[model samples]
Target: MPQSPTAHDPNDIQEFNLDAVAGILQDEKLDYRIDEHDGEKVIRTGFINAAISFILLDGSLTMEAMWRGAPSTDAAAQVLAATNEWNLTQFAPTIRFFELNEGTLAINALRHVVVSAGMSHNQVGSYVMSSIESAVQCFEWLEQQFPDLVTWKDEHHDH
Candidate 1:
């Protein structure tokens, strides 16, 4: 005797919408606010007020965390070196050094995933959680390099 085919689960066929994204975040009790940028809705939230921006595109989502007032002067060189090393070694959360101000440099850790076709609620949750976790991990690793990267704002106060 042969076995019969089973139907696909509806729970797995989830639509990628801001509301669904918020629902997932709400379920985790994480505070998130929706903001519109260029007519696209984005999710803004954080870990310990570190600040992370979530960009939801047609079939993709991205997470960006910036370390303001990061390495400067002598430290800038070291951070550039470390950033090159991290980018060359790590696989997740691509890191980059940017000059946001006149001289100070900021570090950005970014992660992205494509989900335009659609996904299950659980899949969406995993994608969102993974993005946040990886971003935080990247920030933590950089902090280990400079130790004071976490206090960039507290010490500067002018940013």
Candidate 2:
């Protein structure tokens, strides 16, 4: 007879770590590096020239994608309107706009996940992939909305 499926224990828990994140990235065939920033482990990955970071913490993960297509200050109002619309409608990544300089308005796609009760490998992987996919869609929509105004500013390349 086929073996009975095993049930996942609700009490099974462990500190969320970069090793798991690395595995997820590898399984997805995405190139990434686990690095330290202010003593916290971060998994860095790139989509084209855009940079995305996965921050590891106890029972939690935060993904932030630094969008390369930043709008100029002259179009700040338009950018803000687009962000407002996205926030009001979408469910995945949260968009935050910051005035990086007098001329450039930068935006980041941020998502936070908390699994205090622990999660399965596949569950976590779903969250990781979905986060990336949503951010990409958001950037694409914004670019389409302002094709001429959007300017690329890859943070990884400036230095």
Query: Compared with the true structure, what per-residue lDDT tens digits does model 2 show for residues 1-159?
Result: 999998755344555555777888999999999889999988999785358999966667899998887688888888889899999999979998999988898889999889666666776788889988998888878778777855555475456
The best candidate in terms of TM-score? 2
Backbone clashes in model 1: 1
- lDDT tens digits, residue span 38-105, model 1: 98888888865257888887678777877543677557789889889988998878888877677778
- CA RMSD, predictions in order: 6.9, 6.2
Kindly give the stretch of ten consecutive residues in candidate 1 with the minimal lDDT sum: 149-158
TM-score of 1: 0.79
Evaluated against the true structure, the overall lDDT of model 2 is: 0.81
lDDT of candidates 1 onward, in order: 0.76, 0.81
Q: Which stretches of candidate 1 lie over 4 Å from their true place?
A: 1-11, 152-159
